[model samples]
Target: MNLYKPTDERIWTGREAGQNLYVYQKVEQIDLELQNIPVSGDKTFVLMGYECDEGVRRNKGRTGSKEGPQTARRQLAKLPHHLNENTAIFDAGNVVCVGDDMEKAQSVLAEKVTQILNYKGLPLLLGGGHDIAYGHYNGIKKFVDNDQKIGIVNLDAHFDLRSNEDGNNSGTPFYQIATENSNGSLDFPYLCLGIRNDANDKILFERAREWNVKYIESELFHKQNTSYVINKINEFCKEVDFVYLTIDLDGFSSAFAPGVSAASPMGFSVDIALVALDTIISTNKLISADVAELNPTYDRDDQTAKLVASLLHFIIHKVSLL
Candidate 1:
């Protein structure tokens, strides 16, 4: 818990241009430790950052994603506000990873997430790496009853179901979740979209099949099967009591998301990704979500950061309706 940093008031700032109200003017910094903050019968959202890329480093990928949260905040702050005046949106700050202790960092993140969920506040996590998913899922499990069916929907170019044999890393989060499911925690109903064939190995596919994970390959997205994908997402959403959505930026084409830990040339486009995201939001089953793998070091002119911010803005706007 010592690793948890309370929200910084300085990160939200923007030029007051015209009649537009931006997120910087609306977001409030709140203590995650507080219990039972009054919500006005509306969906409340809390934003937290996981400031650790140790998982990416362990996976031998790009190493600068530790700076992702701050950059994402800066971009998000400048976006025009879309939620109502009374909407309870708070910045809960970051979970810092000191030294190379990734497991401890994840444990701390899980605790923080559980704290937010304790008050029925939905978490919108800004990741330090895809490994954030493991901690995110654990937190949700802690809050939701074991009898409730929680489904995971990941939009990523890779399955991320790699064995954690060497140890847990960004590539092993889903596998960790699968292992937990195998231990009889709950039935794992996972739907992975935007899977690029070249990004994953034969062994990964074998593991996915062995685990009975349902996936929509990147080729399907490229072929413009929007209706089919939407139907699949709806079906997945209908079967779960709660949905945990994780968006890995690398799932988008390198042209749209070149600043990720792993950029794939054959990934899907932004428009389709947006459509899929909107479809998920429409389900009213989404309980928590996160945007992962935004490596600012590899970003071009902050394009990826803007894309990340825009996605968050869209989420906030749509979720406010539900």
Candidate 2:
């Protein structure tokens, strides 16, 4: 398992003798190798943990997200199953960062993600940090042709396009990606949702424009005008063949998602957030997805992890509907 550690604690326990649907033990935890998952069928949700946060530490953000994968697994396992017998789930375990070599960890994650997609399993990546997006994107690139159009839709507060001159930190994945595009390496049709103007600076905005990045401001996600946001997503959906969806917990208001690397004070609400996600998911063009920045250390009573699980639950449920 190169950089991967087998998923061991996906199990859930409760007090007293009781029948429970919220317990993770209710679901099966199989030790899945890349060869075991089905390549074509009803589709299974393959859970892979990207367990490294060196990027966040480099980005000067909170560093506890390295533990995000297992924390999220605890909550996700308890989510009530909404799909039928036709659909199943598998845990491929965590890609542990044995050292501070973040680049190596990301490359390893990209390889694992490629294996999962090759098997026709929908990779539901649990993150170490939002930097997970870089490797996550690379994995999707493996299954896609260079001539094919792939849209990257990031649900986050920051552009994450910060200059990588400082090296590959959590804030610089997209910038490194766009720079990679300078060589005409591959197509990166990117659209960032929930970007807060206050969180980014003039240089970042300038870089975004230079990269031709499409975005919707965080303020627009308010009550009066969320439909336009949906319209923006729908329009972005129309442009590409497949979309790589990344959800950053910080994209939501710190009130709802306080357990992230960098919490946003004016982030979107859970209600509208779900709406935008459903709009994209319903389109059925999702290639793969990841939920990043779930730092359980900062979370209030596990609310953020629960929210991440809810999104996962809803996403799997929606896929089953399709």
Candidate 3:
């Protein structure tokens, strides 16, 4: 099977032509097949798309999120470039999932992510489903030493620890990771923010406790609990040498992000989400991140795509400073 496909360079064109002014104009295109990928003197970010929704399909959810990367790329292209000249951003194409082979697709994604990390590049992955977490996490895990502590910070409504006895679907990635850790791997310190109590059941909560997953409920994401949330995040960051951040679009209110596999009517807003993101990024331990479950099929006027792009913009701008 072909593990990946190169991104179409034409998507990086901007409406207004300015020297290094917008993302489209400033972004560089690179083929991952190449032996040598040129890195910048400063921080380098690589965008890799995982084009598959088989996991969501198996999980009995809506499925057109396979096109998320393409839609997000189009939105990201027109955004203004806020990074310094030395900060390089490269589009590393995508890891395409063929047929219903979620395992193969995820393995390929892990290899690609490991490649970027080996090149000293921070991966900003575009997901086909939240199952991207399994592959994304393993990629970082493969790159870092076994002894080095790594933590997972997930922004989502679900614990994603469902049993994969039937099969590994979108809801079983974290459980899979936890299972792997139980087999004598490194410590799995997971912090989940913006968890909606209604989305997860008692069994899931039990699983979370069994795995010792640290999570903050969606109700605690308001101004009154801002300091408390930040303090929790800080404490989590302090326990790990590295962090892998994953954002599920369903974690946000349907008004802000309607195009997702699972819609959370009582989800948190983007403002408070940004606050949590800022706290995590400030730790300077984030190695890579991904945004998942963006199904454009249910989007209203491209609202969710714009939100994802805007978040990407903010992340790039902030990471550029580091």
Candidate 4:
């Protein structure tokens, strides 16, 4: 689709780092139309950016993730090689949000993601907003068999089950997903971890219960009890065939991850979050994933961006071993 703008402004980097070459110098990127994209049998990743934050604006939160995709690329491209095995990664370009039309942008993302999944490549989206979840799920749905169960796990401060009663916004993606799942034959096994009670209202909690969503609060999954949370997630993963993990940067403490739309002061610590992430990866159930809500304009010394790059490196390295 014309909505996709493919540019290599940051996908290339210097090779002076030797065997520790960054992804930019090694990864293949798509600079052509989505229809002409090729499939690779190796551990292929199709990285797409949802460069729109209209959903964040509609939900009355900070907005700047439109630059998230490129920002992440800039970071990922230059990271030291960490993978244990050879892999193929692609930069599929960004789905731009023009004229404040987020719906169209999401549609384009869905189409692009579907194409990648169809080619047997895992789709790893860079955040524009949590609204990217709605588009991300749609694309996965298009590629999965009708009978395959899809379980979604969100690592965020809020439940994101806010009413679409107002309209489609960042806080309404999971609620919208629930409604869609209810109308279809697939299971709605949604698990949200690291949620902060203060970040969501009573009504949102009620909505989560109504949707039969399962969640683990931040207080219960802090640094002191991450092992417990890992056990919980492993049990949750037992119910589905495919897993999609989305990490909203705001789920981390503002001190650790200040570059988000809604920074949380008492959120998960880096160690706790990393343990949870590593445990999830170890489960070997993850099919696709994305890191959302990285607002570069609000970052402190690029802390959040670097953290994301670190997580991406870890995930890629682990997935390669699997």
Candidate 5:
């Protein structure tokens, strides 16, 4: 597979695009024999892909920067098609882009994610935005029975639990999930973590109170050490059979991760964030994971992307050890 350079501006197409974006060399085909690895025993596979580019412009504006299509495609190209030799990784490529139809974009994402889950492999979804979580959760809910509750640990600077007042934008993922589940569709235990105080809407806060969802504000990080955060997460994870982990880059301080839709002044330090993630992965119940809301435009010389990539590496490595 062709790996695009970090600064490349070319818009790849056809087989080149597929090879550049989708196929990874880490693991063999989904049906092929798994390679032996010392860490996780080669049982885990990763379905890696990018989705939801329609809101890139809006998101860029929100973050006070501009990483357009070319930058996004370039950054994605730099990601490993496969992270490890024994782990099969699917690079599902860019399923949506700007100027594309919204319904079409959503449908494509739903279809691709559904295919990824059908293999029964853990999906390591790279994001175009947090809204992609709605599609991700939508796909997961299809395979799980109604009685089997899945827990979600959303690490974000903002509570994305706002109602879809203007439709399914990037800001309304958790809200969409909650709305869907309320009607007897997708029933899951959801937790929002690392939220800053200033980022939430009054309505979202009211809804969170009404739903009794457990959330840890960003202020809590300053008030306690990493162990405190880890223990809180562990308590939540213990109540559910499976867990979905979503990390919004904005959850980190703008100094650490400035390339997001809304960079928060008050967020976790990188070390503390890593400690919290370590605690989560150690639980051995993370079924699917995604890192979202990474807009390279506002990033300081690609620092945010590199940080996100490192986080992904840590997640895979730590999970492999488990």
Candidate 6:
């Protein structure tokens, strides 16, 4: 159960040995059981916890007067403890505290994720920000064989493909991924879902179109049923051998998830979002997944964190069934 040990000397004194909250085994027992159940090709789930407070500090101007960054850390802290009992916590402990250094943060994340994939396990990442996706994709790219294709399914309000306007902030993950081609080609097929129209930048949209990324706008999901969205996702998944799923909390309606950098008023309802996620997991080719951008300070009584926890549970349960 003692999966996480605070590396920071300053916080090490406060660390309580056998404290279940700071440990992984006690929190994610259920998930581990699922891993034990096994799949044909050595399937495993490794949860990589990268707590990046650095991105927050760098983007303080965009954060405005909100305590978005601190809130993100607090909400993420609850995850290791909450999932400990479920047997789903991956590794001896996959939590890595990257104390605000962007380059080091990316390196640490990339190394851990590469290790996970090397072991043939799915990397379920819990993020510091959307910026983390850049490193996440990079790690996955390193391990994927030349014959295999990696696909990304991003569920977010924004496209996140911005072209480094403010030097690689939260809004430019996909741009980083798309621009970086390893071993002679774009590493994956990046699909974005639940995007809010107003949240997208014109340049980002144009870039997505040019790259042939498939996306479903929020308005389209509202107009159609879950089956329609699922069908679209399935179609997209058909083109790739492995898939990486990224869920940004901002994709949900403000009522359900207000703990995010940019809250979207007319976003997808919780029920619809779950339905979409359920459909995606059913594909059985999810290589790695992450849920990011949860800022607890803007949340209404922990509603957003609770909702995210429940969705995580659902995703784990569904994957276990496969």
Q: Which clashing pairs does model 1 show?
A: none
Off by over 4 Å in 4: 18-20, 32-37, 184-187
lDDT per residue for candidate 3 within 1-322, as digits (tens), equals 7879989987787678647788898788888897546868998999999998999999999999999999999999988886778899899999998999989999999999999999999999998999999999899999999889889999999989899999999999999998887757423699999888799999998878877789999999765788999999999999999999999999999989999999867998988888888888999999999999999999999899999999988888887786
Using lDDT, give the best candidate's number. 3
**Global fold similarity of model 6 (TM-score):** 0.77
| Segments of candidate 3 deviating more than 4 angstroms | 183-187
Give a tens-digit lDDT track for model 4, residues 91-170: 77888889678888888888887888877778788988999999998988888899888889898998898879878999
lDDT of 5 by residue, 134-243 (tens): 77787777767788777889888777776677666677778878877876643347788887668776777777777767888877764356677888889998998778
Q: Estimate the TM-score of every prediction.
A: 0.95, 0.93, 0.97, 0.94, 0.78, 0.77
**All candidates in order of lDDT, best leading:** 3, 1, 2, 4, 6, 5
lDDT of 1 at 196: 78
Clashing pairs in 3: none
**lDDT values of the candidates?**
0.88, 0.83, 0.90, 0.83, 0.64, 0.65
- Name the Cα RMSD for model 4: 2.1
Q: Per-residue lDDT for 167 in model 4?
A: 85
The clash numbers for all candidates, in the given order, read 0, 0, 0, 0, 3, 20
| lDDT of model number 6 | 0.65
**RMSD in Å for all candidates:** 1.9, 2.4, 1.4, 2.1, 6.8, 6.5
For candidate 2, the lDDT comes to: 0.83
lDDT of 1 by residue, 1-322 (tens): 4788776788898987665488888788876666444564677889999999999999999998889999999999988886776787788889999999989989999998898888788899998999999999999999999889889999999899888988999999999988877766424699999997799999999878877788999889753688999999998899899999999999999889999999877888988888888999999888999999999999999999999999999998998987
Candidate 2's displacement at residue 146, Å, is 1.9
